[model samples]
Target: MGSLFLTACGNLNSSSTSSTTTTTQSSSSGYQTTGQSSDSEYQSVIQNGSYLTSKARGVGITQNSENMLNLKAFESGLTTLSKTEFSPKDYIFREGQLLSKSTVQKWLSRKSSSNPTGLNPKDNGETDADKRNPIYVQQIEEQDYMKEENGKLVLAGITIGIGMNRKDYYQKEEYGATYTTTISKAKMIAEGKKAAAEVLKRVRKLKGASDIPIMICMFEQAPNDSLVGGTFYAYNVSKSSTLGTWKSTNLQSSVLPTTSESTAINDNDESSFTSFKNKIQNFFPNLAGVTATTKYKNKSLQELHVKITTQFYSETEIRSFTQYVAQAAKTYLPSGIPIDITIKGSDGDIQAFIARESDSSSYYTHVFDD
Candidate 1:
């Protein structure tokens, strides 16, 4: 990730040669009159810095070196074999006459050596993968189709280059003001709608299922603000049957002051996490019954190293806990077989442990198995 630093520029003053002059007169009331200046020097300096930062974040050269190399190889490979007399005029490599198969192979080999990971070695092999040779084969096909059907290559090399560069620019400034103020605001309105449509499509897959509703949250920072703390938007996702669409609901808003202390910052994070968890639980009652435990004790003394054993139970009572424990363990057990939930016969003997997962899908999978 690239870092954004606040830049300062020297303040510029008006030249004495300018016809504009300022005369100040102070009265007993301490009132003074001043001439109107072309611009405030300090204000101008700040504005200039802001403009430069925005532009730099907008068009900064931050190419994905790997992707560019791959693109170059694709273009070069097309240029090499495109020289044959029998080759199609609309083909990607029409700059020269076609070369022999061996010559083409040598060219490809050289290019591949330069970027071993860019082009799959198997692409040139005599297998199903070989059929997909020619690095930019898709581009070539698209170009040919465009010329044959539309009468021209609607998208040129320059256009492709610009698109690639724009992607690089976005990646570099993903957390910068250029993205939030200039790009994301517009993109969120447009792409967020598109994303909502796609979400609706997926929700349709679960039409009548009694599963819990899905929620989405978004956070955006203010312009001229660094992403230090508490600057984001949150939303909840829900399907609207009456409107036949999906919608997001705002949850909360918070802002961290520039002089906020470290303890305050930590408290804010914990509060946000807890609030989010509570909101989910409120919306999904089933989740409330699902208690998560983080420590467990092993019944067998031989496994003293694993002294702690954990288990999960649906019922609130300690006795009924084992039944829920068995259910949780069943998910990971082999098919056509069952495992004993009771580590020991004593009441509340079953201990439950919880583990965090990287994604929402398996958020609770590790607790029972591991």
Candidate 2:
């Protein structure tokens, strides 16, 4: 991974002396800093300059049947929640390293006579549709936090994300039409909590994970037809095998230029996005389309990501258009919030990237050379 930072914009800092330098701060856990990878990788956690990724990366993609939006949001949202307890300054971030792909696959399966370790409801031969067991747990994700002790990195904490299905689709016979089982929010939460408890019990048995604090988050996945992904609704951290009181999160995702009346969209934010879209498109008439996927917390915008498609092919045109986009973003979009914009050609290759960090007025721009 060539400098793991998000490629929305290539590294814009030209005066950097060393590429290996990482953020240094006093650790509350009293562990001295060692080394970390470059901070650009969006998926990997970086703290105290140490960058270790999951032994099993992208496993969630194959395991979970949800759309890519849901998969990405599920993991990233869990990391945001994990930070309240596992501070980046204190703990080194690692992806899902503890739970192997096979382990998670087993946990996602339905409980049966042979598969005794399955976490889902037991398979029963019932003819009635009402009596059938719905597959509550769809996918599971694990993230590990480590700290240096005795000149060695040890497991400090763990966070597990349990993705629950809102609609379970199945086929009764071979090459048959699929049937949908809709799970109510109340029923989903109850099953999610039960799965959390059982997951905690098994995770505690792993080596070196006996006493470390573990955070478990429950995610409600969107329906199949939804363009936006799901959100983590509740989470709880446990010091041992026993879980504690659950806390709820208000994190949610919405597509820009609202399409649904059920989803409450902020008028100001929507209008700002509309303005930004109009400005960029007006600058270049050859543009194909502009869209955004936004994430909010407690009804406040937290992150805005835009994707622009264009028919222009010239590198000079791409760079010039990116500059206009950056200016339009600053003038019309919401200030003091993280914003990322990517310009792509009709072929789907990224042409340029522009990003604005939270609370920063400047925008970083990069146009990829062919």
Candidate 3:
């Protein structure tokens, strides 16, 4: 493919809708890959307006099943950074097709007598938890970007996410008592970069992907019990086999209402969330709860994801409540940043969705019926 730079500006005003048909392919490693048809077409999740995702999803779980928050943040957080380099307007989004489940499984394994390609430190005989070499790499994720050439979509760029463990949890035997080993931030970054460098080299060798501009990010995974996900601390883009100087991402994730003593959040944003939460709950006292997860880049709010749980079952009541929520979101929430609010009933079914794009004055709303 030629240079990804384009003279035509991409439309980022609001979400656009597209339709897709599903098809499944089995990787050589035996993992079933479900995605759109062979047309290389894109499909949006209906709620997310930013980019169209590949009809075929990537074939693997990149995060621990217990820590789902990190999985969501890991993929979406990388997307936010990827957008800075690869604009969704110019590139169609697809899950990491280059890395398969079996390939990732080998890479994530600890280097030992059997698994030499493993990215983690080799196992040395040691009973002391403090002296043992911990598992630095937890999982790896890939995102591919394609650009049109000769009226066909071709691979133009790739983004790789390296998820490292802040705390390594393990069990010597099946169903045995679990043990934990803490990894320092310094050690984590060093190992993560080393693994990323190796990953770049391997990806460069993948079929016909050589010389493609690749961006690799280093993420610190949160503990299994953390309420909020971890953050990406550094990233670098490589156009060749050798990686370049790393740059700090300054990306962070936090829960709304500012509950952390160490996390420094925008006072205005916190106050706005508090007011919005209070206003709706005060009006509808039977609400189960109201909460949110926020993303910040360079300490500025970039995205807000809100979830409101209620007990109301009537469509009439849900529609009325959605209207009130939308009004409150516009009047009180921070402006010029994308905000997504989802209201659900006690049964956990989505009742309505409200969203606002960045720099847009007005918001959009939708109420679903049974």
lDDT of 3 by residue, 1-370 (tens): 3322222123333334232222122311111112233232343221122333332244224446768878877877788788888876666666666777778888888887788889988878664568778889987888887665543345788999889998998766679887889998998988988999999999899864798899999989989988788889999999888998899998877887666554447888888998999888865667547888888889899999999999885788899999999999998999999899999999898999999988688889999986
Model 1, 1-370: lDDT tens digits are 0111222233333432111122232311111111123221111112212332221121212222223332333332222222221123332111111122232233223136554422112334422222323222011110110111122111111001001110111222345432211333544334434433343343334323113232332322222232221111223334342113332322222222213522322343334334433432333223432211111112111100001123324333333433343343333322221112223212344344322222222212122332
How close is every model to the real structure, measured as TM-score?
0.19, 0.83, 0.80
lDDT of 2 by residue, 1-370 (tens): 1012211222324523212222232322222222333342222343344544566666778755647777877887887888888876566666766687777877889888887889888877652456778888988999887665443456788899999988887777778877887888999999999999999998898877898899999999877767778899999999967998899888778887677564546889988988888887866657558888888888899999998998775788888898988998989999999999999988898999999989689999998987
Q: Which candidate wins on TM-score?
A: 2
Better of 2 and 3 by lDDT: 2
- Model 1 regions more than 4 Å off: 1-181, 184-186, 206-212, 221-370
In order of TM-score, best first, we have 2, 3, 1
Candidate 1 CA-lDDT value: 0.24
TM-score winner, 1 or 2? 2
What lDDT does the true structure give each of the candidates?
0.24, 0.77, 0.76
Best by lDDT: 2
lDDT at 310, model 3 = 91
- Candidate 3, run of 10 with poorest lDDT: 25-34
TM-score (C-alpha) between model 2 and the true structure: 0.83
Q: Candidate 2, which ten residues in sequence have the lowest lDDT sum?
A: 1-10
